[model samples]
Target: MKRAFVPPADALIAFETAARHGSFTRAAEELHLTQGAISKQVRQLEDRLGVELFRRVRQRIVLTDAGRLYLHEIRGPLLDLTAATRQVMSYAGSEDVLNLAVLPTFGTRWLAPRLGDFQKRFPKAGLNISVRLQPFDFGAEPFDGAIHHGDPVWAGAIAEPLFDEEMIPVASKVFRDRHDIATPADLVKAPRLQLSTRPLAWRQWFDQAGVAADTAFQGSRFDQFGMMSEAAINHLGAALLPKFFVRHELAAGRLIRLFDISIAQRSAYYFVYPENRTLRPVVSTFRNWLLEEARTERTDPETMLPS
Candidate 1:
């Protein structure tokens, strides 16, 4: 049995595009070629296939019956081929996916709520998240990027500022009612839930309030904010927590501010990514979106501090 001769893939692509668009000019524009180039390729395809692929109608082109049917058959395959080719090229140029390391508290309280918008925008990209403790070695980690507090200080990585963190004293309404804390001195007697990262949180809060608690005041300590927050909500005690971490809870009345005093921390959050040529697509989109979000939040009067 003799097999039919096959035409070049480029010719088939040109013909398919021309047939679908019904205009060589539009097809050429889409393929980044001249109209004459597209017409020539389509003509070559027609000659090779021995079929009239298009008909001239009042100085415009229309696909013939054969052309339409051929297109219907080849269009799906052509699109699939194009998508597959793009995927391969993307893999060659950049990472297959992005992995993000984040502090658990901020991830849950702040970043997690807003991740849907990022996914909606870049649904093709894959995102994997892990909870990170401080003083981590990036070289030892699989994370392509990290949302971290304070300076990243990691060599050979690009660090972009995400947002500043400010600490404030927060307690559950039930806890506050039970303790009846009216002044900084009163907070000393209250059980204080603490984060291991900020061991001196209670001391700092008390110092800012002009009252000194027994630096030895024993209370619960946790390695993560989510746990501490849950404890606070359960009325375990007051936690010296970040304002941003508890913004949603505070707004919802799940947690109430013990005092109006806020101390801007020396540490601020930064988005850190390894300095590599194979950039993850999601990282750029996320970074840009976060910067824009920060800008909007900075200008909004509701988020600003009183003059």
Candidate 2:
């Protein structure tokens, strides 16, 4: 295996601190080293990397273009390393931590609500969840598993089916009152909101509603479902959202169901983890628990529809 062009930790730290303060003297003070030692460390790093990290203008030190870019790249990894070290140091006993990356809305709306039950089932298994917009490298990121939405195919990972998307139309009561939304077809005429990720959502809903909406694809686009739901609440446009996302809003009457229309997306959500982690107790426990929850998930059809 080829070795990476990496410098010593002290050298990297010296460069980073110097870059932050724009002075070797300040960096030395922060690192509890002499100014000359700080200068030597930075010089060593620059020579090893074959890049000029700083250029002195008169008496003032300023980062070269390459220096600024390198600092930006390493700052995050450095912080992450420190955090990881601290996390390990804080471990009390045999308790294991399961790091997870999850779709933001899915985490907020679905997984979050059920986590209490997860804790009750396995009190010792600790979970650390971070919001993710899409699937990422399980090998690169420090994650035990992820909740994903797409096909059941991920490199170096096993995809376990969680649930399918159940979509419904929703609009603010004021927006509903303003528009003559008498039929499912009438929704095609009203202003609509779109989730940028799920471009086919509205079109699929219209097709299921037996409406020929050529412009179903046209609308105010949003990147997140949370934003789309809020836009609908404030009367931006009608939005097609998953039942999980708007359960509270629909119940609270903040957003009203437009009509008795629905659609199940072709793709479903999944619990994905690295292949080598299959036998790990935490991974298996969470996967089995989540799958059971998905199977039992149901929305009373009558309650979902307004009479």
Candidate with top TM-score is: 2
Give TM-scores for every candidate, taking all chains together and pairing residue i with residue i.
Answer: 0.61, 0.82
Question: Can you tell me which runs of candidate 2 are displaced by over 4 Å?
Answer: 1-8, 24-59, 64-77, 86-94, 299-302
Put down candidate 1 lDDT per residue, 1-307, tens digits, no spaces. 3345667789889988887677888999999999999989988888888898899798689888998888888879789788657645654534445667888777887778887987687667666677886646667766777887877576777778766677878888889889888777888878888788777767777778788677534688898788988899899998878777777788778888878776766778888877864565566776787787766544543223211
Query: Candidate 1, clashing residue pairs?
Result: none
True-vs-predicted CA distance for residue 293, candidate 1, Å: 3.0
Writing each residue's lDDT as its tens digit, candidate 2 over 43-123 gives 888888888999988867899999999999999978988888866664455377778899888899989999999999898
lDDT at 245, model 2? 87
Residue 292's lDDT within candidate 1 is 78
Model 1 C-alpha RMSD vs. true structure (Å) is: 15.3
Best by lDDT: 2
Backbone clash numbers for all candidates listed: 0, 0
Q: Superposing all C-alpha atoms, what RMSD in Å does each candidate have to the true structure?
A: 15.3, 3.5
